[model samples]
Target: MSEQNKTWCPNIEFNETDEELILKAELPGVKIEDLIINAQTRFVSISGICNPDKSTDEKEVIPSQFNYGQIKCNTPLPVAIQPEKTRAEFIDGVLTISMPKLRVASAVNF
Candidate 1:
């Protein structure tokens, strides 16, 4: 944890208009294939491995803020979500996920 980014909380947001729950994670220099997404009946989990020294595969001789280890976060879903109806993309160093919220029907009489 750095002095500047010591107050960062990675979580998902529910966009009512979009009718989907979006999850945003700040993972600098994370590869697409290194990330893993798993969705269950009422929850979703995302995790990725970060290797700051992967490009060279050389021995690391120093430690710094850039050194980020495995990151994984499991978020509880508000509504049932289709496991197959999920999309993820990586841009720069952030990961964006869009999940379509499941719809539950209710019977009402007028």
Candidate 2:
């Protein structure tokens, strides 16, 4: 397939703390403005576009293994989360998402 028609899925890592769940995705060559992130109580979806190298002419370019095209990833969260409180950050080609876990109140006996 052509570079622009290819689809790539970024590598993702998941971690959890006592109060929150963390998701990290490696998205090299993807710009912040091109990213789209959405989270629900049990799932998170990420999509973006990575533009192909434009500085070099097609005739002068060497065959490369780099991926450039549409990026997509849809993963289920390990635990229930507070979707309204989810936070995300992108830095150094990495995207980090912090989701606070849903807390259930225990029954109290009088």
Candidate 3:
């Protein structure tokens, strides 16, 4: 888990449906307000920082091992997507993004 802490959370999954691609990102302890979602073409990126712990605010003296800051990371998707049609939702610190795939015309030889 420490190695994962060095970067963003490692837990993620991708699912493809007839009309859309589903992406789920795990972000524990992160507030919904802090998250930012941006999508373009086939790539989507989300970055955000977890809110500071409430206990820290009451302390008169600072701790030596406490680490708090704006934690942000970006990840790329495997396929192209329509950014404007994309939708996102967050629940229990997990972010789920849905992107509709672009349509392509194919030719058939008779």
lDDT of each: 0.68, 0.91, 0.71
TM-score of every model versus the real structure: 0.69, 0.89, 0.71
lDDT per residue (tens digit) for residues 65-96 in model 1: 55356666788877777678888888987777
User: Which residue window of length 10 is worst by lDDT in model 1?
Assistant: 2-11
Clash statistics: count for each candidate: 0, 0, 3
Output the better candidate (1/3) by TM-score.
3
User: Which model scores highest in lDDT?
Assistant: 2
Worst ten in a row by lDDT for model 3: 1-10
RMSD of each: 5.4, 1.7, 5.1
lDDT of 2 by residue, 27-68 (tens): 988899999999999999999899876666566357667778
Best by TM-score: 2
lDDT of 3 by residue, 1-110 (tens): 33224334326789999889898887776777877888888577776665455685586365424323445555676777888999999998678899999777799899
